[model samples]
Target: IKQLDSLKIDLSKTAPKKENLYFKNGVLYKKGILFAKGIEKGRVLDQFLKKINFKPKSVIFIDDKLKYLDEVEKFCKKLKIKFLGLRYGYLDKKVNNLQGFICDIQHKNLKKIFCFIQLNRNGYFQIVIYFKNNKLSMLIF
Candidate 1:
């Protein structure tokens, strides 16, 4: 909350009255504010639209979890709202250390290993593994 508080601009004269912002609160509100149990349900979009009393031409839902993105995508498709799913990426020195871990695991367990890597898509490293007859067959993610 301190970080968010720092970003607030004192636009007292320039502020628009119709514009309102609501941050996620873990408590229930009985009056004006809309609350949700979680993001994965995709109900927040509906609540927001209802609160504004407007049907937008498009909606963008950003989430780090692929499962939540998938859920929101489904809802957006049903509502004919243009949707884009974005995976949040952490590009830190820690990611470089992950390369060594990947190599160590491959050397210890797998045979005929191959990896195809590309740059800067989401700044995330994901490993997808496939197994055939309880043996590791493919790894690509």
Candidate 2:
């Protein structure tokens, strides 16, 4: 906590108390949690394929990893290659570890729609992002 006070950086506006300060290896930490959270696995998958200049049917990259199958399905059908060892979990560990950033901040309380990590009748985590214009966006981490 002393380290964060010295660095002069806010961890997350929403989670100022819980995430305001973290000691990384007994050192100071001042990175925004939302900045990292927003780039989570699903989001990263979206960004990853977008970066490859591949747009689904327009282009496809075959891989043995199956967890990303959903991401590929967004723009393509399926590849002949088999997806063997793949895990479903956090993709952006660096940002995911940042657990207190404001993915959305509202001047006044507004309705937010969060997403769940797994497919269940009862959801796990909820995500809601609100902008300045009273508009709301949903994201799952």
On a 0 to 100 scale, what is the lDDT of residue 28 in model 2? 26
Model 1 TM-score on a 0 to 1 scale: 0.43
Ten consecutive residues with minimal summed lDDT in candidate 2? 32-41
Alpha-carbon local distance difference test for all models: 0.54, 0.38
Looking at candidate 2, what is the lDDT of residue 127?
45
Q: Per-residue lDDT tens digits of candidate 1, residues 1-141?
A: 222348863433332223554645442322333335454346675656665566666656555567777877787888888887876655444565555565665566565444434332443555535444666665433
How accurate locally is residue 22 in candidate 2, as Cα lDDT from 0 to 100?
31
Looking at candidate 1, what is the lDDT of residue 110?
Answer: 62
Candidate with top lDDT is 1
Report how far off residue 135 is in candidate 2 (Å): 2.9
